[model samples]
Target: MAGILILYATIEGHTARVAERIAKGLRDKGYRVDLHRADPAGASLDLAGYEGVIVGASVHYGRHPGHLRALLRKHRAALAARRSAFFSVSLSARHKPAAAQRYVRKFLRRAGWQPQQAQTFAGALPYSKYPAWKRLLMLAFVGLAGGDTDMSRDYEYTDWDGVDRFADAFARPLDAI
Candidate 1:
């Protein structure tokens, strides 16, 4: 069987971590998974070899990476021809579910690619990893959003169990086939 393709775009690295967890869940179910990082400079992707594909991206400032949107536009037909899913990672997913859903809707509408499955996963706030300006900015944002504001440490909001469930759901139809 052709393997499942797990492609992701991350800025602060949390989205990549989420993608890895999803890949692990699918692999545990006996699916071959290929994990690839989406390049911001636009890398060509061929989806013919994969039985299914899962695309993930982190939303920053209300937007997903432009290159990922471009990739979806370019590969929409190939992705449509196969089983596919999309998951969006963002801070809004943790505090504001509606906003998170809007992000996904906007992204899909702009890209013109609708996957068979879609989900929203809360992301992390890696305060320690950010530069001073970003850390302060995030601190203020978190404070206003009623989230963790401790800049000395990072906060993770992702639900691992949910990610596993999503992986299982994506694999079910393929397994049936």
Candidate 2:
């Protein structure tokens, strides 16, 4: 069996963590998986060897990473041809579900790629990791969203169970295909 590919683009690392969790879920199901970063600096990747692909990205400032967009555009056809899934990680998805749905739609529309499954996962706020300006900006956003404003401590809103369910569902398609 061809292995699965789990690719992600992360800004503050939450998306990377989410991707790892998804990979773990698939691995637990007895599937071989390759976890990779979607950064443009890395070597080129293709979908030829993968039975299925899972793509993930973190939303920052209401936008996903530019590299993710480019990768989606570059591989849309290959992705559409395979059993694939997409997940978006963002703080806004927890605060404002409707806007998060829009963000995902916009991303797919722009990339002209639609996967077989899609999910939205809440991301973490690592205040300690952000620079001063970003921390201040996030503080304001969190305040407006009625979220935790304690910059001294980080907050993680991702639901691990939901991630597990999504990963399992994605793997089911691989079995049928």
TM-score (all chains, Cα) for each model: 0.97, 0.95
> Taking the tens digit of each residue's C-alpha lDDT, what string does model 1 give over 1-177?
448999999998998899999988888888899999999887989887799999999998889988899889988889889999999999999999999999999999899988999999999999989999999899898899999987777889999999989998899889865
Cα RMSD to the true fold for all candidates: 1.0, 1.4
Model 1: lowest-lDDT 10 consecutive positions:
40-49
Instruction: Compare the candidates by lDDT and give the number of the best one.
Output: 1
Give residue 161's lDDT in candidate 2 (0 to 100).
Answer: 98
> Any runs in candidate 2 off by more than 4 Å, and if so which?
none
lDDT of each: 0.91, 0.88
After superposing candidate 1, which stretches have Cα over 4 Å from the reference? none
How many residue pairs clash in each candidate at the backbone level?
0, 0
